[model samples]
Target: MMRTSLDQGTSDVSDQQGGVRTRTRAAIDAPHLRTDRWWLAPAATAAGLLAFIVYSTWRAFANADYYAAPYVSPFYSPCLAENCDAMRAGPNWDLFGGWWGISPAIIILIFPLGFRLTCYYYRKAYYRGFWASPPACAVAEPHKKYTGETRFPLVLQNIHRYFFYAAIVVAGILTYDTVLAFRDEHYEWGHMGLGTLVFLVNIVLIWAYTISCHSCRHIVGGKLKHFSRHPVRYRMWQWVGKLNARHMLLAWASLVSVALADFYVYLVASGAFDDPRLF
Candidate 1:
């Protein structure tokens, strides 16, 4: 119970159920009383995310050094233009024709980018890192009023479910790319190199991140009234739930792995160094 006195600028607060103890709270007008540095997490998050954005945007536009004989950058996988003659990873997926002169990665990256942009985790991350909406706990946001995702650009987050479907297709393509990475520079099967190991790790992290998505969890587990009736879905849902718990960790791991994988291919394709054969 709180009894406020306008004249005294204090409140008589009962600290116990039976009013056995009473304490007065003299209001402090400061925004928050936190004494420690609370901005470090958001600052680091902004730095990491911003660094990735700069690197990815630059690489997406570069368009060169994204493919070597048997390895292709994840950014340019499923390259879909006639110009992708040497760069093409799998079968001739010249879906976009030769008229498209820009980077093939431009066509391929949109789906996965969309999936991550609208991801529930990324949204929360950028919301604090970039926007600083109440940046940390007990902190007051700068805005005078709060208008959530009810408006224009933010409202587009509702399409996350659609992006989830596109991500599944992209993951499948990357998986195919990872399989191709097992070959040597001469395209011989049963060969493994450092690049092959990189590709394998990248693909595993990507799948882990995708399968651990909240949308995946809902798709496999939600909308079921009786778990006893559907044994298969129940089992799958249990599996997804386990991964979902580590979704954030997987998200960061996959993000770094993809960039590193692409960088490795770039180094090899650019003739900076040959992908060292491991086996």
Candidate 2:
């Protein structure tokens, strides 16, 4: 009888507490164990985001050398203003013409930038990386009360779904840019080069990232009750879920691709390097 009682007692530690599990502190606290290298992720994220900001800001203001034959910097595409470049690539909206010497990218980057800034994953990332709001798991935030997304600026995050629509249009524009990259300086078909490949890969990354967005996934799948009745959305939902699973990977990949695409165009336009023709 004692042996059976001991075996039962040993097996059910959780039941001893009467189906309740509680930590009595009444406040969130870090673990007692040593935290090793907990700061590295946030530090690295800060460095990368800062570097991209500085470089992008410099390139945005540089204005010149953003266009080479058959290759325009991703940062400067849809160069909507007059005096942009000889390529005359886009619609030439020209709303801001040399006014304070702002680059077209200054005007154009807002939508796409807004999309990423309000992204759900990015919210978590920068919340930890930049804001250091609890920096990592089991860490404490600097603030006493957690305001979350209820405040003024955070309230604006609700517009991410709207931004997703605009981003799809922007992706279409980028796809056109990729098509243009396929042509040579003379606009002949059957032309391929390192720049072409770069643009191609960049657009693919952008599409993957954009398509796999949390907003995109929810729009495709959420609110559906009967999957059998909606076979198409169900299929799309399934595929997007697969991509969404790797959304973080796609986010960083697309970021790097954009920077590199712009840099490649910069090199060609500035006469720093030639785009090797693979045709």
Candidate 3:
């Protein structure tokens, strides 16, 4: 009776081991499509965005003449008749100023793009674009697992309100650049180059984007209980409300416009295109 009992116990152990091996093999062989389908849309979007970024950045850096030449003094002879010869010889290719020898273009490009990419709105868009194509028009489905982090770094997205302020300031600076492009370069209003038009469009795009910021909408709307009752406030809120409705579209277009503007400017400065006068 004891021998029979021991034999039965050994058989039970063997069966348990076999069950675990079968489960392991099944898991290893399972189709990844079942688990990875959610990432398809987002991954494709990200890849496209990355390609655009790489192409634009490469063009910006490769077009050396777009930037001021090395060792050129800021005090180079001011050209009177659209002659950039004297300016081209200057060492201070640094358009803005020598703040740690950093290029102003790098500074401007990094902040707005960085902030937008990290913005809560953008994060939501990216996540939905990736995991859920044709995102639910209204009702968003919740994720099965809360795999996201709960740390301060991630929580910093709350500072998007402050980033909105930075965006406005940057937009203002770009506007100033637009004005300088005409005034300093002697560009006639009607006779502007491809670069000038691109730059102007970029400014408009950025304006649309800035106006569509969540914080700007709230501030304009006067989020108080009796805000709509006030006439002036009501009108402003209505305007902001219209813009806020198209915020996502504005955001994407603005991004594209900015990159294209830079490209046009680079091409013009590099002599890839003749700077035609609009007038």
Candidate 4:
């Protein structure tokens, strides 16, 4: 038998029992042995997520400049209150009467926000970025052990499937809003503007991100003994699987798209500039 021991900067291998058995030495004491810059990724993720949270929170509470003619901010889409008339994208939903005085965006942002917050990729991103739980591969976490999602706060992640349902509805509403964006300020058909293009691209990315979700993929085709028996679902599952491969990309792209789309609406609604008609 061969026994191996590793010290601060040395390694010793000795024959113990004159057998073929070998014991491998490990650097268990060091936090991490990585020589490269492993902190950069987590730092960048924290910065990006923090920046987006601050910007979105400010915009959500602004309660103004969220609507510009047919263009509506994604954060404030499906505006469902009487106060939405001033910033109405489509016909006022009037779901909540005059009683709800707060920003209408506050009422509807929870679903989409919940979906993103509970996302698997986002869990990994924030866990590594903010919590520093084994920040990178081969790095040891500061905590002694993990309870995982079995706890109170972490257990909420299980509701991601429900959030996926709400996200689908939100995506549908945004699709309707995008369709409305085809009209001009006068609400006439056959019109296109720079904002129209922006909305179009943003909605496309949103749908791509939403549809590529893990829940959506599972719902499309998860538990089945045979794929051949259900051809349609199998085909859909194949498509979703391919999209799922790019879920992270779609997630970030949609995040930026929604923010930029809202900013464009803000610029136009604030009267900073007119939406240049492409027609």
Candidate 5:
């Protein structure tokens, strides 16, 4: 009986040690799982954004209205001239295709997709927005350190200074286009082109995006200086910092507005929508 009792006690001790080992392993592995879950929100947001883009593009292509019919629609009235019926009668309605051998409409359509997928603000937003895999979530597993992707190309997004210059130029060109939209075939300002409104909105959206960028804020503020040494500089930085707070909001809205602007222009060029003139 004594021998049996000793053996039983030994077995119980071994079982307890095994249970402790199992628990230790589990505790080590739990963090990795939590870190992974943090990524779910951003991934979901990206998927949804992609879906809308695809649907909108497909709709733009499939619609028969994309090919302007007999009469210029009410939407084009801003540029319509006396006896302007001749411009709308033809089969060729694609302004971008006519101006550039490559369709500007298609270029505008695809530009945002590339920018958004690689945008710094978007990366941060996704990192924080996702519940399972937030940006700061680190794996607890020592052996399984999450050395996934280096944010090199992403960090290069700091080149928004260069992009700001480009955006300014583009905005100017768009503004010019807006002016052109008011001119009839006779080259006089008549009414309003729906395309003009769309183009103007696009300019505003791009401005919002460029201005709200973190890099732009830094450039404007002049990086990290002590307020005592440079109060004016510090104040400027503070103001920009305030705007930067809404950078994500500006980014997403800019993305949407630019896309819609292109879509509206495409519709007008395709003849899906009419621009009627009242004046």
Candidate 6:
């Protein structure tokens, strides 16, 4: 996919204030230095992202303590593997073989992982935070060569639209998992607890993040020529646009909420704590 600079227009502007003329240029000269707290933001972002990756990877590989009665880790939901905990098993496909009980999360997280990895906001965040592709505003990047997302593995990012579609299906499945949380071990309805609340919040945040995706917005409205003719589409697009404005917030919030949801289930299943019941 071709990339265009969002900060393209109005690169140079002149302002007169306090009887002084000052001019600002958008593009900075290479190898420049400005003494400021430039590295802090990117460093913090990298730390947060790296921590999440490490934690999620550990949980994904973990085969135990992902389920309790009426509560399942979000990471291990839609459990396709046999030998999963009896309470957490979801449509077990008898996947893998004896001597190997793989976690379903290992297989299922790829789609949502790809969706987040290739997100527009995340691209900018990581490109600056991890890769240091100009680490921060007015800072020179570490790489001597810059090919951008045009070559080889970077080109794979073009498939993000497809990943967006996959994310929608995953969101649906997770939503269903939340609905299932309403039942107890005996399949009796109206069961409620801390885990149920966690799952409910997790699904809502995931839906918010997924539905507010730029790709979703584009798919819903990109080809339309007239907002006048397609009032319904236009209204939906408008709402999506409003959501898209806060996509980055939803993205991070959903990530944290989902991880918290999984960790909550893990703790309960592991007997670290008892899941308090409300009804």
lDDT of 2: 0.80
Error of 1 at 144 (Å): 1.9
Q: For residue 122, what is the lDDT in candidate 1? A: 88
Clashing pairs in 1: none
| Best of the two (2, 5) by lDDT | 2
> lDDT of each model, Cα atoms only?
0.83, 0.80, 0.55, 0.86, 0.50, 0.81
Give a tens-digit lDDT track for model 2, residues 91-175: 2456566553567777778878899999887888899999978688766556656788899988999999999998998888888
Compare candidates 3 and 4 on TM-score and give the better one: 4
Q: Candidate 1: which stretches are off by over 4 Å?
A: 1-27, 85-92
Which is superior by lDDT, 1 or 4?
4
For candidate 2, the per-residue lDDT at 277 reads 99
Candidate 3 runs further than 4 Å off: 1-41, 56-63, 67-99, 128-150, 183-191
Model 3 whole-model lDDT (C-alpha atoms): 0.55
Overall local distance difference test of candidate 6: 0.81
lDDT of 4 by residue, 1-279 (tens): 865665543433442211112235441445567889999999999999999999999999998998888788888888888888454348358899899998999899999999999998899999999998869987767775688889999999999999999999999988888888889998888899999899899999999999999888888996667899999999999999999999989999999999999999999999998999998
The ten-residue window of minimal lDDT in model 4 covers 14-23
Cα deviation of 223 in candidate 6 (Å)? Answer: 3.3
Off by over 4 Å in 2: 1-34, 88-91, 95-101
Q: Using TM-score, rank the candidates from best to worst.
A: 4, 1, 2, 6, 3, 5
User: What's the C-alpha lDDT at position 5 in model 6?
Assistant: 58
Candidates by lDDT, descending order: 4, 1, 6, 2, 3, 5
lDDT (C-alpha) at residue 111 in model 5:
34
Report the number of backbone clashes for model 3: 13
lDDT of 3 by residue, 32-131 (tens): 2243355555566677577667865664334244432211111121212222233422222344433423223344455676668666567766656655
Candidate 5 stretches greater than 4 Å from native: 1-40, 52-118, 125-160, 184-186, 224-236
Encode model 1's per-residue lDDT on 86-106: one tens digit a residue. Answer: 743463488999899988889
